[model samples]
Target: MKIYDEKHLKNIVLLGAPKAGKTLLAEDMVFEAGIIHRRGTIEGKNTVSDFHDIEQERGNSVFASSMHTEWRDYKINIIDTPGFDDFIGEMIAAVRVADTCVMVINAQHGVEVGTELIWDYIDQFQKPVLFAVNLVDHPRSNFDSALQSLKERFGNAVVQMQYPLNQGESFNAIIDLLKMVMYKFPPEGGKPEKLPIPASEKEKADRLHNELVEKAAENDEKLMEKYFEQGTLDEDEMREGLKLGMIHHEVFPVFVTSAKKNMGTGRMMGFIDNVAPCPAEAKPELSADGQELPIDPSKPAVLFVFKTHLEPNLGRLSFFKVISGEVTTASELVNSQTGAVERIHQLFIVDGKSRNPVDRLVAGDIGATLKLKDTYTNQTLHAKGYDITVQPITFPEPRIRTAVIAFSKNDDEKIGEVLHKIHHEDPTLMVAYSKEIKQLIISGQGELHLAVCKWYLENVYKLHVDFESPRISYRETIRKSANATYRHKKQSGGAGQFGEVHMKVEPYFEGMPEPTEFPVRGKEVIDLEWGGKLVFYNCIVGGVIDARFIPSILKGVMEKMEEGPITGSYVRDVRVMVYDGKMHPVDSNDISFKIAGMMAFKDAFLRCEPQLLEPICDVEIMLPEDVMGEVMGDLQTRRSLIMGMDSKGNYQVIKAKTPLAELDRYSTTLRSLSQGRARFTQTFSEFSSVPFELQQKLSKQLQEVEAV
Candidate 1:
């Protein structure tokens, strides 16, 4: 294999909805480029992209696969990404490094929910895109309707570069408006023979050809003037104009393809190689400090690791793109995040499970290396003294959460280590040990996402884990002030412990001042490690309790706060004042004072009308408008407060505040209700008191569990 420069490298990513044949099209593209002799199908479970065992069982791509091929003297690095929303993290990583996105659309379904979802990401990255209407030979395929839908949803920027000459089931030929020629494929469908346009289709081809020339000319002033004078653009001029137009997102050329039959794939590859923006022409890579880095092989070496794979027997493989300069085998580079130097011993160009060893990876090329000691996904590796960090890929936050429990006692000891490995492979899947709830919480994009993680744990690591509904982190706080007193005395033949405490417990809020009715001797406001504040005021007029014992008293109060009087939940937003207390000279040690303080705080908390507060989250749901009524009604049942509503094209976004306790399995429920046409995200908002009836129920449930 020969190394390609930045100018001749095309980093293209395949993106679309699930079952849109993105993986099949990738197989065709690879086969068309002569990288492989025969194309593989998803059903066969032998495709280059979906090679993983899990993907083979599911018959869908679950991870992004990197493969490249040389065509027309240009190296096209094709990143085939999963279309399922649960695996959106893979697509995001691929899109981050891609120069152009080939969004495959299902001809039968037109624009689907998955396509719309990925379109938002493509728009976010501002990547030039080409639409490949795949599955054109399907019985229900509707190319015209699909084209109309594209025009309606994405505007006139979607211009047809090629259209199928025959309808569904008879789709064997494609008419190229750009070239003004027809490509008639053999019945077996490999390469097509080029011929003049049919007499019946010449008029329509001429009309679309003129439209293409006009769209291309609009990208440049000189091209527009030449088009006005010559009434059309020459082939060379139109290609240059289209390239410029694509860079600015002014044109999104649509191509026709029957990936299953290998129809129109060769022409799609030709357009990508000739017109798609190269690495140097696409957006410049930005450093972590917001400065654009030049894409030059002669500059200091800098690489961004976008994806990491833990192969069964091969160990860790870090897939990266050379952002600047060139990296060679056995060259040393520093991990920009850790500042640890690592040697790149063997670099390989990845093609799914197969790796082609390469001595060097130049700028704009994508490849993988094994055993990078200090390198991981989203980390930047650069030459020494360069000190430049590339901006990391931004992954979506986990949407669904559940507590993971080991099935066997022996597996418990190894769960954390296994989870850490899983997290390293997919950063979007998070594993957090909640000390307060005493559970290991695993969260991901949805139920399927976490399920896949569980499968990996059981199959790969041989550890069985089960997911359970996580306990809600409710807080207990008082609504009014109260006063209580307690006396502590212990005698066990040793130094007797005796201390009496009288204190006032009041609900605290930010900016509240100390009580002025009693003289303030000392004051300490401590912010609880969990949340809220505990303001302690010492108002002992004549040192009723020694000043040294005040901290001991506060500590006891905090201990009571940790295990609240009402429901054993953590207490918050309470202020305590030790205005009066009695201390014995010999027995009023820190231990005695702490016991007295704890008793006094608990007594007061019980008498002050305490309330249980549950966490609230701001949830934004995007769903089709047809399901808005049903979803909104369901939300009302969950005690949700509808905040606002907005429109996003054909979808509606419903913003609401709902208690986290009421949102268990909400992602799964929403998918069922909307037929998998809805997506949502939630973030912690604030905590609010639970309803009186709900509080009693929770208290009863807790008491029952404790009794057991």
Candidate 2:
């Protein structure tokens, strides 16, 4: 195959809500372009985009795949991304790198949350976008209602560039408003037969044509004048007017197709070839470090690594977007962050799991390279000293978390290694060992996201894992002060262990002295440092207690501070003043004073008001307006503090403060209540005093667990 430069090609991502038939459209496009031997069904697991085992078994695209095919004289790089919100990170990455975005809307379902999300992203980047109204042959498909709803919800810019010729089984032809021609299709795939509008559907065709002409006239003044003078527009003039309006965001051209039957796939390809925006066509300016960088192929190289992978077979496939300069095989690229240059050996344009070697690449191209050292997703690739890094892709923090482990326990040692591979591939999925809870917690956007990862582990890495709820990281604090004196006397045949010490324990509001507090506590609310000054005043004028044992007592106190009292949690924010004490010079050993210090700490902690602190999170929930009542009721049931409720257009946004324990699996419940329309984000807000009843329960549970 001849190498196609990025300048001649346009990359548009097919994105929408789940079950929008994006994979079927992909398969149909490949079959129509003559790139595949036969069209493959999603369930058959033979489609080009949904090739992975998990995707095939689930009948969906989990990962974004890069597919290249030609339409007309233009080269198109089509990206098919997962519609499930769990893998939304992939959709964000695709839109960031593409020149224009193609959002597919199911004719029956209308606009969904995923569609709205991608629309906002495109608006954010100021990228021109196209809308495809797909699945026209379905029984429940309503073209007029859907189109009207799109226009009402989005804007008046929605223009009917193409219309379906029939409904249900009769949906074999498409009427092109741009060319003013009817392309009819036979039962089998071939050149669609051209026919005149049937007598029964002529009135429908006339009404659609009048609406298109009026919209086109409204888009262009010249076309308006022609329409007013002649009461009609030439098909060519209307096409040009619609194209201009669409490219300028003045009009949204809606096309129709049945991807399952491969009907209208050929026409859809032609529309894309004629309308998809190349990198230069939209003239989007790339921004970095508050400066606009020109997309010059002759300039020094600048690319962004949008995705990463560490496949067992292929060590690493670092996918990147060429932003400025030309990148050819065998050349080297520098890591702008690390200042280390890596040699490029083989460049592969990835299509699903298979990769095609490309000889050379230029600006605005997306491709993959294997085994890049010191490189990961969101890293910048540029020339030496090129400090300009593309602004990172902003993603919502992972909300759901679960504790996972090796099912057989034999792969425990390899868990870390296997997770690193998964992390390299997915930046949104996070893994960490929580020392507080002693569980390996994995977090992602939702349940489907983590389920897909577990599936990947078993299928791709051949590892079985168990999933459980994550344990909370609670904290303990002391309330008051107490002083206690402890004495140790052990008589033996040779030497005797005799040590006595008296110390006063007080709350250390300022944390420890200079060593423990100043440096590490920078600006934290609590301070616990080891360099605190323990003043051993030696007030005993008679010197009953020797000074030699002071160091041992202080050391013991520090040890107790680490392995706290009441619970197995760390103790903080306290000061001990060892003003008076008596120690035997020879018999007063370190062990004797150490024991006294531990007893003193335990005594003081018990006297003080030691209370447990629970973590609270600031949560913001967004849902449709109709669900507001149920949402408020649910919040009250969860003991949530309602911050406020605001409106975003037709949607209601609820702000509240909720405990972390109550929100662990809230995403699943929210979907059930709102019919999969609600989404929320949570951030650690502050620590609050736990209720007395709850604290008592936790104390009892901790005691029982410790005893076991």
Candidate 3:
């Protein structure tokens, strides 16, 4: 493999909704470059992208696969990403390393919810973008509607560079607005014949061409002046202006393609080679110290790992982009994040699962290396003394969670270890042991995301597992003040245990007045790990309870708080006062006082009307306006509190606060309700009190479990 310089290397990520023909487009692109003789279809499961077994089995992309092709004088590294929201982490990683994003829109559906969701990231990253209106030859393709949707959703920056002369079934020609020529492809669809624009289509083509020229000229002052003086800019001048506009995200160029039929890809690749921004021209990355790090092969080597893949038998493959200098085999670089020296044993430019070994990779190039002991996703490696670290990509938070159980009792520990390995590869899938619930919990984007994880465990690791609803991390607190007394006495042959504790318990709130009636002496405020606070006061007059035994009593209170009397949840936001107590000088010990304190606190807690507090989540749903009624109705049944609503294009945004217990498998239900036209994000909100009846029911269930 030949290593290209930063200026000649172009990295583009294919992004769009599911089933937008991205994998097929990728196959067509590599074929057009003459790297392969024949094209492969998605149905054949032999495409250059989507080579993973899981992706081939599902007939959709699950991981972001990398492939490269040399077109003209430029080497283009293509990252094909999955469209499902569950795999959003893959897309985000690809976009972070890509200089440009190629959003492939399915002409049949126009701008879908998936497209809109991806555009949000594109807009945030502010990278130069271009659109490939693919599948234009399908029977249901509607080119005009798709074009209109782009313009309406994306504003006037959308400039049509080409359009199908005849869409759907008979689509074989495209009128190029930039070249002002018609490309008529052969039935087999490899090379195209250049022909003059016919008289009948000249007027419309001229109108679009002029619009493209104006859009391009607006980016550069000199180009705008030239357009005003000469009536129109020349081809080279227009390309220059468009390139400038693209770098600043001021204009987005659109082209038509039927990737399934192998048409128009070569032309698009040509434009990409000529006009798209390279890494040297794209936005410069910032270091951890806020220093600008430009792509330059002469600087010390610095590489950022954006993705990690663990092969079944082979070791880990770390995918990274060289941010500066050149990386060669056997080059030792310091892991900036770990300070450990790692030698690059090998370097390869990958084409799906097949890796082509190369001696060197220059700056701005994306490649993979195997088995770096200390490196993983989002970490940076650089030469000694550089000490530069690239800003890590911030992944989306998990939207759903569930408790995972191993089918066999002995596999529980093994299951956790395997899941941690999986999480190492895919950061979006988080695994942790919840001590409160006594279960191992796994969280991801949605149900399908977790389903894929289970599939991998069963098939790849030979571990069978099942998923169950995760228990909510509720809290316990009191509502009023009450007093109780407990005496612990156990008399044996020697050393009798006798201790009595008199305590008053009350609800604790921020800035509440100190207990005046009890003559508060010393206060200890504890910040609970779960949530809220615990304030304990030593109110004994003349030391009715010894200061030494006071700590033992507090310890007892803490034990009971850990396992709340009402439910087996953490207790928080309450104040306890040990006003008086009795301790026998000979028999009283730590254990005796501890038992007395625990019993007294528990008795006072039950009498003071303990309440159960449930976890709540802030949910934001985006769906088409027509389906809002049904979605809102479903939310009502879950006891959701609708906060507000807003409008974005033809979609409605609904924000609500809902209890976490009621949101199991909600993403699947929303997809069904909206026919796959809806998307949502969930975040933890403040905890709120559960209803009275629900609290009673939960307490009864806990009692039944204990009896069993």
Candidate 4:
């Protein structure tokens, strides 16, 4: 391998819908570049990207795989990312470091649900994108329709750079519009023989070539002036203009490829190496302090870890991109977040599962290293004096959740450790123990996401587990004000305990009126642990109760608040005022007052018309318009309030607020309802009261659980 400068290095990520031939295309690229003697197929489970055991068994990419190939004096670092939304974290991490994204669209199916999903993220990162109309050799391939679809979804910026001469069953060659040459490959497909464009297709090729040149010229002033003067751009000028167009996202050149047949991949790689933006040309990354961190080898070394994978026999593999300077073996860097020093023992440029040891990784290069003591994904490693941290990737919140329990008691203790390790491998898979629900909740993008985690735990960790619907985190709150009195009397020893409490409980909100009896002896506003506030008023006048015992009384009220009086859910938004109370001279200690206070608050809470508040989430579902009615009706049954609706390309987005309890298996349900064409995202909104009809049922269930 040769040491290439950042200008000669191209970091590209292959992204698209599943079965769109992304991994296959990557395999073809590597083989064409002579990095591998033979191309590996997904079915054979020998592809470099999908090397994980789970991925091999599933026959799809479960993680992002990094591999590089030297082609035409350029080091092209290719990252093949999983198409499944469940493994979105991998796609996000890869796209974050990539200078250009090659989004592969299935010629047969065109843009799909998965394609749209990944496109949203690509747009979010604002990375330059090139489209590869792949699988053109498939029997049902429709080049015209696929091109039309791309234009419709992504606008007219999608201009053709290459087109298949004979698509589908007889797909043999592609016409390169820029050069006006035809690449005619053999039936078996390898390198192509360059020939002049056929007279029959010359007219259409000329029109497309003009469109490409015009799109390119629009990106640069010099190119625009030259195009105006000469009526067109020459080959070199067009390539330079296209590179500028791509960097500014003013043009997205679409190339044709039959990855399986190994047709047209070489031309695509040439275009990427010659036209795609390099890492230095990419937008400067911002540090945590909002300072621009450019790709400069002269600066102190700063590497950002984007992904972490736990290998079977080997330990953890941390994939990082050198943002500045260079990293070599034995380079000492400090973890930006933890401030722990890490000595780089070795540096390796990854080629699929193979680790190619390199002496140093220069700026803008992606590589992996083993066993960093205190570094993980989204963290930065920098030279000691340089206190810089790259902006972290923001992953989507987990949509589907299930309560997981160990199959055996021994496995119970190990589940936490195993889950932590799994989380390290894929951050999208989240594990949380909900003390309120008394269950360990494991959440992910969808059912398949969680299923894969379960498989890993059982097969890899030998910890069998079962999953069920998770319990919703409902809350309890009062709706009205009420007053109550309680007397605590205990006589067993020399000093008897006696205390009386008179307290008023009322619903509290910001700007609410203060209690009338307050002389302002002591005032404290305690933020509730759950989600609201507790305003405790000390209206003790005339020295009826000592002010020192006020905290003890408030403690008792909080204990009751933790376990609400109506159900066992945590309580919130209630104001308690111990306006008056009786205290015995000898026995009215903290314990007696606390007990009396607890009883009084409980009695008052019961009379105050308590209500159960379930967590509400804002859900945005994107699906084909045909299923809009069905989905909206289904949401209605879940007590959802449809906020609004909008349209995006061929899909409709329905925005609604629904209770989390109603969305237990919504991911799976939505898939089944829309035949897997619908995708959704959810975030926590405000909590709302559960309906009266469901309140009785939940109370009964709580009682049964408590009794058990």
Candidate 5:
């Protein structure tokens, strides 16, 4: 393989909704470049991208696959990403490394919920974007409607570059607005012949051509003057203006293609080679400290790992982008995060699962290397002594959680080990043991995401598991003040243990006044790890209880707080005052005082009107207008408080605050209710008091559990 310079390397990521034909579009591109003699279909399971077993089984891309094609003088490195929102982490990682984003829109369905969700990431990165209307030859395709939706959703930056002549099953021609020519493709759909625009389509073609010219000239002053002086700009001039417009995200050029039949991929590839912005021309990457890291070959070598895969029987493969300088097989770089020296052993330019060994890769180029220690996704490797770390991609938090159990008790530990390995490959899949819930919890984007993890565990690791709803982490707190007295005495042998504690407990709030009934000699405020605070005070007068014993008493109070007497949940936001206590100088010790204090606190808490606090989450659901009524009714059933509602283009956004317990399996429910036309995000809001009736029921359940 030949090496391309920074300016000649253009990296693009294919993104869109599922069934939008992104994988096929990538296949068509590689075939048009002559990299492959024949194209592969998703059904045939032979496509260069989507080569994974899971993708083939599901007929969808699950992981982002890398491929490169040489078009004209430019080397376009393509990263084909999964369209399902479940694998959004794969898409974000690809977007962070790519210079441009080509959103493949299905002509039959314009701007789907998945498409809108993916657009948020593209807009956030501010990457130059363009549209490729795929499946234009389908009988249900509507190119005009798709183009209109794009313009309405994306605003004036959208400009038309090409349009289909016939547009349905008989689609065979496309009018190029920039070149003012007609591309007539043969029935076989390759190597189109350029001809003059016919009179029947000339008027419509001329109007769109002028619009394209004006949109291009608006980006550069020189191009504008040329267009005004000569009444038109040449092809090269227009290309220059469009490239500048793309670089600044001022324009999003649209092109039509039938990727399934390979009708218009060649023209689109030609345009990408000529007009797309190269990696070097893109905005400079920012360091972790927010400093600009310019793309300069003369600078020290720096590479950023964007994705990693654990190939079956092949060890780990790390995919990276050369951000600055050139990397070769012999170079030794230091991991900025780990500070360990790693020598590059093998480097290759990847095309899906196929890797072509390369001696060197320059800045602005993407490639893969094998067997690097102490490096993974979002880590930066730089030349020794050059301290620079690139800002890592910010992945979204998991929205769904479940407790997983291995089928056999012997595989419990093994399941955890395998899950950690899985989490290493995909960060979005979170696995951890929740001590409060006493269950092994796994969280992810949605049900499908976790289902994929289960599939891997069963098929790849041979560990069968079951998922169950995880127990909620509830908190217990007091709502009033109460007092109790307890005396711990033991006389089993010569030395006896005796201690008495008299304490008052009350609900705690910030900036509350100190207790005036007893003199406050010492106070220790502790911030609970789960949430809230615990305040302890020593109010004994005249050394009624030794100062050293105060800590023992406080420890006992904390022990009771760990397992609240009401519901056996963690207790928070309460203050305790030990006003008086009796101790035997000979038998009194930390243990004696701890027991007395614990008993007294528990006795007082039961009489303090203890309440339960459950976790609440802020949920935002986006759905089509037609299904708003049904979705709203469902939310009401879930005890959701309608915080607000807003309109976003063709969708409705509903914001609600709901108890975490009621949100179990909500992602699956929402998908079913809206027929996959809706998407929602949830975040922890706060912990609030549970209703009296629910609290009574939970307390009764806890009593039953304790009895068992």
Candidate 6:
């Protein structure tokens, strides 16, 4: 293995739909570069990526995997990321650190739901993307339709670089458009033979060659002039033009390959080395001291840890991209957040599952280290003088949640420790204890993602976790103002306490949704400023109630509101206007009034609507066009509203909003309906009052479940 400098390193992140042969392609790349002896299959339990046990069992890449390979004298660090939408956070972390993305698509399926989601992430990062049409050997695979679909979706910038010579099972090789030579593979796995253009496909070949040259010429003035004078540019000039266009993003090259047969893998590697942009071609702005810092490979070491892996005995191995300067083993670097310096130990370049020890890594190189004291995922490490936090990988908020309890009480304590370690490994996953349900909650992207994580917990931690469908954190509040009274009298004390509180509960709102704003934080919980102020007018004109006792009653009311009027959830945005009260001067104290306030609030809240507001999530279901109608019907059955529909190629992106409660088992339903061809992503939307008819049914269920 060779280590390249900053200007020569090319970080490429491989993306595609699940089961799109991305891993096979990664294995093929390693084999083609002579890094590995042979290509490994997903079934044989041997592959560069998807090395994790859970991933191999699932037969899919669950997390991003990195491998270093050199192509044509250039070091190409390829990151093989999961294509499933559930593992998008891992892809995001990889994207945050990569210069270009090579999106692979199944030639048979074309642009799939997962591919569309990957495109959404690419758009978010605004990085240049290339398309690789893999598995071209499938019987159903069509070159024209697939290539046209990609061109249409990506705006004609997508031009075919290598055209398949034969279709379907006859697909033997690829025609190198730049060289106008056909590399034909022999039957039963012999070396490919270089042949002249076949007579039968000569006309088609000429047309495709002209299209490629025209596209290439548009990106270069010299090439365009050469084309006009000689009707076509030479191979070297055309390659140079395409290279410039690709690096500048004016052109997106579409390569054809049968990843299973290892066809065209060598050509793809050649393009990646000769054409893809290096670190110097894709330098990003570095922030330092509230300003944009220059990217200098000669200066002090400043690298960002974008990914983390928890190994069995290795502790935590963090993957980072060097932004500036070089890092040698045992060198000291300061963490910008904690301002504490720590020495780098065991600096090594990752080669798939193996680690190659390296003395030093220059800027733009991705390397790993074991067990840093202060550094974690997304932490910035630099040589003392630089103090700036690098931008972290931004992941969407977890929309789905499930409450988990120990299947057996014997594993309760162990669950916490396992969950804590897993959460540190993946920042997207959130773990919390629900006092109401008395269950530990683990929330993430979808049911499948959570299911996979649960499998890891049970298998890896040797603990059982019982999962329950998520319970919406509904809030309870009063509608119209109500006057309530309560009196607490305790005679079991040296000083008998007696207090009476008369208070009105008025509705308060935030940003005027009319009733209340949803995400009310700590301050509003105690002092709700939405409706009217809690006027402690102290109308005890004769001092029947001491000032100390009045504050006590108010405190009690505040405490009750925090516990909610209905369920034990937190209450918000409602004011307790304390108008009048009576108390004995000697017995009355702050504690007495507080008790009075609590009693008064409970009485008033029960009388008002006290309705439960369920959480709704905005969902976008991307499915093939054939299943749009069926999907719409399924959504409507789940009380979902179809906001709108947008079509891209053969897929339909249906945007809808539905209650989170109704979507608990949607993953299963979608799998059955679409035959595992459809997937979706959902996020928490506004919380609306449960509809009148549904409210009664939900209320009954709430009582029944709570009772059980």
Q: Each model's number of backbone clashes?
A: 0, 7, 0, 0, 0, 8
TM-score of each: 0.97, 0.84, 0.99, 0.96, 0.98, 0.91
The per-prediction CA RMSD against the true structure, in angstroms, equals 1.7, 5.2, 1.1, 1.9, 1.4, 4.1
**Model 1 quality (TM-score):** 0.97
Instruction: Kindly state the number of residue pairs that clash in model 3.
Output: 0
**How high a TM-score does candidate 6 get?**
0.91
CA lDDT for candidate 5: 0.92
TM-score of 3: 0.99
Cα lDDT, model 5, residue 490: 98
lDDT of 6 by residue, 530-594 (tens): 22233222334455456556666657866775566566555655655555667775676667778
List model 1 lDDT by residue over 163-213, tens digit each.
Answer: 997768988899999999999999778899999999999999999999999
TM-score, prediction 5: 0.98
- On a 0 to 100 scale, what is the lDDT of residue 130 in model 4? 96
Q: Best TM-score goes to which candidate?
A: 3
- lDDT top scorer: 3
Which residue runs of candidate 4 sit more than 4 Å off their true CA positions? 517-521
Off by over 4 Å in 1: 511-514
Where does candidate 4 have its weakest 10-residue lDDT segment? 513-522
lDDT of 3 at 111: 90
In terms of lDDT, which candidate is stronger, 5 or 6?
5
Give the poorly placed runs of model 6, Cα more than 4 Å off. Answer: 188-191, 283-285, 288-295, 408-414, 434-439, 509-542, 648-650, 692-708
User: Please, what are the lDDT tens digits per residue for candidate 3 over residues 593-627?
Assistant: 99999999999999999999999999999998889
Can you give the lDDT of residue 600 in candidate 3? 99
Residue range 1-708, candidate 2, lDDT tens digits: 555555577777888888888888887786777777688887678888988767778877888888877767667777899988888889888888877677788888677666766677777776666778888888888877777767876787777767786766668887766666787878664468878877776777788788888987886888889999999998677766766676677777788878887777777677667665666666555555657765667777888898886666768888888878778776777887777788888888776677889877788777888888888887888866556777777776888899987887788767767777687668888888876577888889888899988877787778889888887766666667566777778888777887776666666554344333112211113234422222322233355555556667767876776656655555655656555556776777789888876777677667777776677899988788788888889888887999998864345789999988888788888888888877787888887677788878877877898889
